[model samples]
Target: MSDDKPVHTPLEIKLKLSLERQPLPNISYYQRLVGKLIYLTITKPDIAYSVSIASQFMHSPTMEHFNLVKKILRYLKGSVGHGIIMKKNESTQIIGYCDVDWAGNYIDHKSTTGYCTFVGGNLVTWKSKKQAVVARSSAEAEY
Candidate 1:
């Protein structure tokens, strides 16, 4: 970003970088970097998946993992001005969308549910919460 150079990375590369095949390495810097990315998720929804993937290894991160996270930082640097905007003149109706994945967490065997609401054509709020009970099915997960 110093001289208008944009750092480019494909989604597959991010996935590969995040796929850990060995035990975790030092994560002090990784923890700090992931914290910054989590903060950015407030406005950068596109980075959410990547940031979340990178954060999974925060307790033990490798050099490759750390570099991939830096790639995300560079991505943010170039796309700093990009974000979602709720237009004032859009639809006035409020609607919500929700989804749940049944027992998606391998470690806890818990489900995760997510919801987002929009007023008119603008998003007003969103949440991704873990379910309290283990879901027997996808339908049950939503309930």
Candidate 2:
């Protein structure tokens, strides 16, 4: 990428476990793998849901969780070309969409908030986060 000329071939990448991923025998490797995948969410929106679910068990990931993360990575490897592309637009409109999952968190009984912002037809930003306070109703969840 440093070179001015565009590279015709896809960039080769090597995914490796980080230092934080090691040193815990009881912990599952899925936590670290999911963390990496979540970081990639900025470029790839397809794996957002899977990564989010896998990340919920970061505090106590299991062997099952690790296998799921590995599967996600394998899926990504086979679909590396999948990603969002920003194109030249004719209009300048900023749009936002918001959604809430009522009492979605099984652990804390909290709702999850999701939103996506777009610049014209391009997806500029998005996030899925657990709400801090418990809501009494779906309307309250959005508020």
Query: What digit string (tens of lDDT, one per residue) describes model 1 on residues 45-133?
Result: 76765676677677777776676677787777778678888677846888999887678765456787888888888877877767877
Clashes of each: 1, 0
User: For this target, which candidate reaches the highest lDDT against the unseen true structure?
Assistant: 1
Across residues 81-119, which tens digit of lDDT does each residue of candidate 2 receive?
768989897978999998887877656678878888999
Q: Specify the poorest-scoring 10-residue window by lDDT in model 2.
A: 8-17
lDDT for predicted candidate 1 compared with the true structure: 0.71
Q: Rate the local accuracy (lDDT) of all candidates.
A: 0.71, 0.69
**In angstroms, how far off is 71's CA in candidate 2?**
4.1
Best by TM-score: 2
TM-score of 1: 0.66
RMSD of each: 4.2, 9.7
Cα misplacement distance, residue 37 of candidate 1 (Å): 0.4
Off by over 4 Å in 1: 1-21, 62-80
Q: Which stretches of candidate 2 lie over 4 Å from their true place?
A: 1-28
